[model samples]
Target chain A: MRTLTVELGERSYPIYIGQGLLQNIASFFEKHQITKKSPLFIITDTHVAPHYLNDVETNLHKAGYTVISAVVESGEQSKSLAVYEQMMTKAIEAGLDRSSTVIALGGGVVGDLAGFVAATYMRGVRFVQIPTTILAHDSSVGGKVAVNHPLAKNMIGVFHQPVMVLYDTSTLQTLPIREVRAGLAEMVKHGLIWDEAFARWCDQHAEDLLALDPETLAYGLEKGCSIKAQIVSRDERENDLRAILNLGHTLGHAIEATAGYGEFLHGEAISIGMAGAALLAVQLGADPSLYTETKRILERFGLPTVMPKHLDTDQVMNAMMHDKKFKEGNMVYIVPKAIGQVYIDTNMKVSAVRNMVERLKEGDIHV
Target chain B: MRTLTVELGERSYPIYIGQGLLQNIASFFEKHQITKKSPLFIITDTHVAPHYLNDVETNLHKAGYTVISAVVESGEQSKSLAVYEQMMTKAIEAGLDRSSTVIALGGGVVGDLAGFVAATYMRGVRFVQIPTTILAHDSSVGGKVAVNHPLAKNMIGVFHQPVMVLYDTSTLQTLPIREVRAGLAEMVKHGLIWDEAFARWCDQHAEDLLALDPETLAYGLEKGCSIKAQIVSRDERENDLRAILNLGHTLGHAIEATAGYGEFLHGEAISIGMAGAALLAVQLGADPSLYTETKRILERFGLPTVMPKHLDTDQVMNAMMHDKKFKEGNMVYIVPKAIGQVYIDTNMKVSAVRNMVERLKEGDIHV
Candidate 1:
């Protein structure tokens, strides 16, 4: 196993990445000084429980943990106030304490929801992310954990970093094809924001990654997590540098909210949001050629290039206004300067965004 | 206005305490470089809104802010998942951005609920506390903001500090007598935990403070906030020194949860919790005389000596397990070392707690 430390001083923790990390749960807990006597709460979703919950439970039991499980429904809906409350009730019922470590074992939805539960449960507790899907590579690394409010997606949450993350790439073999495609979008995003070489690598190895080649997948996950770790360390609370990580997310969040969650996966929404952002960048005088190339690469990964046809342009504009990135009542879109560079631009106006949405609604782009 | 800084480095903010601090809201905004166009959301509750909302709103408006207000029902009940969600929706509707600041203008309940709203809303935002009640002298200074779950009080929340705290002591004159007594308990608590001189001062002048004499009241508020600021600065997240602030809260929270919320003011519950903690300390070989003095002083202030008769010991014990301070399924109680020193003792077992509860139930020695 290779360990990467997310340097947050006392709040710092390790991300153990490799095969069979799950089988060595005892040592992982020992290293963190988390023992069986510690109130250990495992959070998994409905879909994940049937697949891997027993293995996790048995391993934890063997390690002498007084383990309890909180299984939430599997969907975007689970990232709501109701589900959050249920998880808290479960933790309370199961006797979770401050020293109790919560193990979140599932995909992006489970990771975000469970991480958020740990963040707010009894004013925060230590949590470990045992990500079971390809998409969790992004969610598990960043300290950003939130649940979606009905009015807005991810409107409620906290930046609670995990104590440890065991990203066993072997788990990705169970992920559906669409899920793999969604996960690749974030890999592409990591490249677009900071690393051109990684982007080029994705361009060359997208098929290999889709085919579940552990070596290529592990390489992508490490590079993505490393880039995210460096950014989060400098700006854990997203004061400045961390905002860059939300390159496509400003518009991506709006698309997710407008389309209604679960209609488009988070990565899929980001894919289309990146397209909108790229076009907006071109309109605002960024190089047109780089924008074109970025869109081309996203399309090659089987990600959506256009907004959902049924979404109302005005509603999407209203949704963008609710984005956390919106500053001074104006939307701040992070646009690309080139394939490997992005910048936050707050000068974008409502009318300009409206016009862009109108163009997309009119089907002016290729599918 | 007397300005005191809670020195938490970059997270540090000034607490402006005195009469008519509300009039200087514009100046505070200027010093913070906050502009009127920033998405500003003011969170208040029913009890406080009728008195101070207009003045706060007018000042913020004059300062050129696009101000929006979110009001919840006034009480401990407001600090729950249901109300938190409603406030989040209001923030979303008002277009609150990450750059937006949430101004919490009420007592501890409102401060905690609103501060938590800021903490989780968009994964955290700038929040300012404009405390109108005396109880806030303690709550506002510490960066501890949280909402209670059904099974546990403060069972769901985060440790997000405010950008500034505007403590307008003039607003306390409108408070009820019971509320005044409740607020004084925390001041007494601060003295007991860190300053014996202040504790003696409180003991001597308890009647003057109860009468709301401005000189005595202001001095108490200032000294209490200073001591709290010192502790919080050294331990913002309650990892060590900050836990001292929760001196009576372990059992206090359990009693509050068991009795059902809104039945007793936080200080009242804490008053009982302190008594229970003192008894436990004496049993564990700390100074028994110190425990007697604590009980005497609390009784002198008209705080409840006995746990409310209706609460079940088992239920309270269950609630204790949910406290954020509980480590390894064992409750960690903050016990007094002497008149002014507090030490965390985590070695106590549940059977000892049960025996103590049994004694309290049997009317053993006036709590």
Candidate 2:
């Protein structure tokens, strides 16, 4: 197993990446001292459980670990307050306590929802993340666990780090084509924002990475998680350096909210957001070549590089105005200066953003 | 104002205790660097808004602050998931941003509900606690913000500290007799668990404390807050010393849940929990005199020293078993050995608890 540690002082934990580490999940728990006399609660979803839950239960039971499971329906809807309330109910009914552990075994939705349940259950509890999707490579690493509000995405949550993130890449073998493509967007983002060499490497091996070559995918996951871990360590609460992680998130979140969630995957929306942000950067006097390169690389990975046709500038603008990044009426954008470099710009003119959105809405950017 | 710093490193904040500080709320905000150009969202309740909301808003406005108000109903019902969702919607509608401040201007319910809203709104925002009740002296000092779940009290929440706790003692004068008595339960708990001198002082001055004598109440508030702050500083997440703060809360929460939230005041429920805890301690070979003294002091303050008639031993036991503090089928009780000293006993036998409850239910202890 290739392990990368997110150094967060006492709150630090490791991200384990390999093809079939789920079979050895017991040792990870043992090494992390997560052993409890009480039965550990396995929080998964309907879809994931049908594939891996019984295998995990058998492995854990073989290790003499009693498990209580809270399985919800498989989707973003499970991340609601109502579902969260149900998770709590199931957990308590299963008799999980402070001494008990919670293992979140699913994709981003399960990770975010279960991590949040751990964060607030009796103030807090110990939990491990066993991410089953490529998108979870991003969500499971950071301690930002939240559920969506009807009004906003990830509108409610906390920064509760997991004891460990066991990323069994074998699970990715079953991920749908669309999900794999979605995950690559964030991986590409990590490289673009922090490592030019890594970004170039990803560009060279795009096909292999997309085809799920275990070694190539593992290398990319490590690079992405390492960068995220470093950023989160320095600013766990996103005070300054951490805000860079939101490079495309400002406009990205706006698109998702406007289009309505599930219409576009998180990373898919973020791909389009990265394009808008690059344009914003060029307008702010950054090199235009970087925008071209970013769009090229995103397109190579089968991610969208242009705004959706139906989403008008007005809808996008209205959503952007309410974004969490927009503080005190100022739109904050994490603009890319060049590959491997980005800076936060708070002085973006609304008219310029409007102009870019209007052009993108009318397919004028290509012209 | 008498200020006590909570000393939580970067998360450290001050507890300002005095009369008439609400009129100078702007100074407190400035001093804590919670200055925001955006309008402050003042979250108050119907009961508290009439008396102090206008005064606080007018003063803030006079000091060149813009304000938005969200008035919730006055009670535990306001600490629901539905209410939390509404709070989020209202804050968003009010255009609260990362730069905006949330001022919780009521008692514990307001502090918990609003503080939680601040904890999760846009990830988080700076919040100040303008406590209008004596019970808030405990809730506001510690950063344990939460909204209650239908299944449990305070089952969902986070440890988000406020920039400052502006405890305006002047608001206590308007407190009803029942509310005043309720608030004293927590104050007496702080004394009983940590300081013998404070406990003795409380015992001697129970009448004065209940009458809302400004000097005595202020002294008690400062002492109670200091002890809580010290404990919270050492263990912010209740890993160890902090769990002691849950002294009577295990059964206290259980009682509240069993009786229905609003049926029994929080402090009233805790009052009985404290009595039960003392009895359990005596049974466990602690000083019998301690239990007698503890029950006598609680009686002097007009706090309940017996279980409510409607709640039988079975109901209390069932609730306690599901308490967040229970671990591995073992009920964990923070048992007081004497005034000013307590130890966590996690190996209590269920039958012993059952026996104690049976005796208490039959009024056999007094006989």
Candidate 3:
């Protein structure tokens, strides 16, 4: 097993990355000192519950922890106030208290929803993340947790770090190929934002990663989590360095919201958004190769490099207007300066972002 | 204005207490470094809007600030997820961005609801608390913001402090006498837990406070806020010392929930709970004078010292089981150890609490 810690001073926590760690989950609970006397609330989606809920519940029960499970529908739609309220109902009915731990047992959607619940339940409680998707390698590492607003993405949320994250790479084998391909988008984002060699490593290992090769997947995930942890440790609240993590997210969130969430996976939207950022970098006098290489690597992972042409550019721009990055007539964007590094642009013009979104829909943003 | 700072290290903020400070609201905004570039979203309830909304908006407008306001129904019911979702929708529609400030321009209900919106909106924005009621002098200082779950009070919440709290004592004149009496519950509570002199002062000046005597109210409010700020500085998330502030909240929340939110003002329920705590303390071998004095003071303020006989003790107990203070077969209660001091009883038996509840309902909890 390989472990990396997100160094948040007193709030710091560890990310455990390995194969088949779920089989030995009980010992990890003891190691982490998560109290067994309080009722445990496990939040998983329908997609993940059928596969792992029984094992997780039985193991905790065997460890003498009272267990209650809430299974939400599996999608971005599940990240709504209605579902969130229902989950709270289940938790209250099951008697979750201040000391109880809320465990996210699915992918990014479950992690975000469950984390938000933990962040607010009893004015904050301990949270545990068990990432069952490759995409969560990046999300589960950061303390940012949120739910989508009908008019915007991730509009309601808070920064609540988890006590620990357990990633069993064996779970990757159960993912559909499409989700696996989409998940690589965030893995690549970690590289695009800070690590040049890791970006190249991802490019070289694309075939192995796509085939669910456990060793390759585990290594890539650990590296992605490390880069994310390093960034979050430096800027826990996205005031400065952490904004770099949102490289593709500004435009990416708009695209995902425009597609009504499920139509385009978050990673796929981010993939296109990253291509746009790379293109904007070239427009700002970055070497045109920056745009070409980002596109090439994304395509190699089978992520869509173009936004859907049918979606209105104006609608996407309107969605961007509601994003956290959009300030007074400008966007606070993380634009690529190079393959391995990025810089934040506090005054990216609205007209320029509109043009970039227009070009992305047309698939003509190539350098 | 007398200012008390809740010294929370980097997150510390001031509570400004005085008469008619709302007239100079714009200057406080400038003094506090609240930005004017982004649209400001002010959340006030219907009860407060007709009285002060236009003045607040016009004052900001005169200062070159753009402002929007949402008026919710006035009462505890407004602190529901449904209402919370509506407020978020309004804030989003009003174009509130990352740098925009959300102002809670009402009492504790609005503060908790709006503070919650600010805490979660865009994963949090700047928040300001403009308190208009005596109850808020206590709540506005600490950053415990939340919306009540259907099953229990404050079942969903997070501790996100405000940048500053503005208390305008002149607004107290508009409060109904019942509310004024109820508000005294917290003021007296501060004395009960931390300052014996303040508690006796509240008892002595109950008539003046009930009549909206501005000088007495302001001095009392400042003292109360100072106590709250001091305690919050020591324990921000209720770990040890801070739980003392919840002196009557455990049973108070249960009785309030049993009555349904609007049937009893929060302070009224807390008054009965505080009396019950005094009774419990005497039952545990404290001087009988403690119980007599607690009841005498509560009655002088016109606060209900006995729980409603109609309320089912079992129903209140069940509601309490869903509270944050509930643990495995016991409760973590903030019991009155003596006048001006309190202690947390982490292993208080369930049966003893049940007996106390029965006695409270019967008006026979004399030591």
Candidate 4:
């Protein structure tokens, strides 16, 4: 097992990356002093519940922890306020209290939803993130937890850190190939924004990383979480440095929302977004070679390199305007200056972004 | 204007108490440097929108703020997650962003729902509390904002303090008499938990305060807020001292939920809850005089001295058992020790609580 700690003052917690760690959750609970005296609410989705819920319940039960499970539908729609309220009701019916802890036992949707429930339930409670997707390597580390609104993505939420994150790489074995391909985009993002050497390492090992090789996948996840933890620790509320973590997310979120949620997996949209960001970065005087490298690596992972044809450029622009990153009607782009380096460009004109989208549509953004 | 700061480190904010402060909101904005470049979303309910929303919008517009209004129906039902989601949609449609601010312009329900929206919007934004109800004197200051869950009250929410609470005493003059009577219970609670003298003052001036005597009402509200702010500063997450603020709220919330939200104004249910707590406190070896004084003061304020006949004792107990305060199958009661002192009793048996509830229903308890 490899351990990395996200240092967020008193809110800091550890991320444990390994294979088959789910079987050993009993010891983790004991070490953390989460006792059976206080109940445990295991929040999962239908997709994950059938496969791994019993495994977790068995382990926790063996550790003398009384556990209750709250399962929602397995998709982005489960992150709505209606589902959030329902989950709270179930947790209460399960007799959860301030002392009781919540464990999120699925992919990013479950983590985001359950994490949010823990964040607001009783004004915050302790929760653990057992992220089952590579995408969650990014979501699980930072304390940012939210649910989407029908009009916008992640519009209602708060920053609540988890007590710990137990990443069992073995869970990757059951993911569909398409999901694996999508989730890897966030790992690529971690590299593009902060670590040139790690970006190179990811490119070289892309095949092995995608194959779910335990050691390689675990190493990549640990590195991704480490970068995320460092960034979050410094800029917990995204005043400055934290915004860099949002490198591809600005355009990515807009594309995802425009394509309609679930039309493009978050990472798939982000992969395309990173390409657009690269184009924007090139306009900001970045070395054109960086754009080439980012696109090449993303394509090698089978992620989208351009915006979907069905999505309207004008609609994408409108969605971008609603992004939390927009300030004073100006869209702030996190453009890459080089591999592993990005800068915020708030002075960019809307005409220019529209032109970039037009170029993307025409397959003309290539340097 | 009298200003009291809820010192929560970087999250600290001021509470301004005076008459007609709403008219001088432009100056307050200028002093606080809440620039007009950022948009403002004034969230008000139908009841308050008709009375004061225009005044606030006009003041903000005069200060150069580009203002937008999102109005919901007035009452407790508007505090549902459904309403919360709808409010987020409206705020987004209004083009609110990181620089934008939300102003809650109504009673406790509006303050709570709007405050929660501010707390979670874009992971939080600046919001000022323009409380227009006497009950808001308590809700506005502590920043305990939330909506209701069908299963429980305040089941889905968080603690996000406001940037400022601007209490315009003049707004109280427009409140219906029943509401004014109901709201005073929180002030009485503030006095009971931390300030014996304030309790006496509230009892002596009950008539004048109920009559909207600005001097008496403002004085009581300010003192109540000072005590609450101090308690909140010391324990932001309710580890210990902050739980004392839940005085009368355990049974109170259960009673409220049991009767159905909007059936009893919060203060009315809390009045009955305080009576129950007083009885429990006496059984726990408190001075019997504490119960006598509690009943007398509640009577002076016209607050309910017994549970509503329609509410079932069994249902209220079941609701209390699910309270966030319960731990390991034990309900922790914040029983009053005296006029200004209270202690947490986690070992209290349900039979004892049931006995107290029966006494409350039968109107047989006496000092």
Model 2 segments more than 4 A misplaced: A362-367, B362-364
List, residue by residue over A1-367, the lDDT tens digit for candidate 4: 9999999888889999888999999898888888678889999988888889998999889878899998889888888878887888888888888888889998898999998999998788889999988888989988888898877788888999999999998888899888899899999899999999988888899999889888889889999999988989999988888998888888889988887778889899889889888887776577888778889999889998877777888899999888888887777888888888888887778887887676666554657
RMSD of each: 2.4, 1.8, 1.4, 1.6
DockQ (Cα-based) for each candidate: 0.78, 0.69, 0.78, 0.77
In model 3, the Cα lDDT at residue A74 comes to: 97
Ranking by TM-score: 3, 4, 2, 1
Interface RMSD of each: 1.2, 1.4, 1.2, 1.2
What does candidate 2's lDDT look like per residue over A237-289, in tens digits? 88778888887887788788888777888889898888887887777677778
Residue pairs in clash, model 3:
none
Q: A188-280 in candidate 3: lDDT tens per residue?
A: 999998999999999999999999898899899999999999999999988888888988888889888887889999999999999999888
Which residue pairs show collisions in model 2? none
User: For all candidates, what are the clash counts?
Assistant: 1, 0, 0, 0
Question: Per-residue lDDT of A287-344 in model 1, one digit per residue for the tens?
Answer: 7776578778988889987777788787888788777787776667788888878987
Docking class of 3: medium
Ranked candidates (lDDT, high to low): 3, 4, 2, 1
Better of 1 and 3 by DockQ: 1
* Shift in Å, residue B179, candidate 2: 0.9
Model 4 agreement with the true structure over B198-225: per-residue lDDT tens digits: 8888989999998888888888889999
Off by over 4 Å in 4: A363-366, B364-367
lDDT to native, each model: 0.83, 0.85, 0.89, 0.87
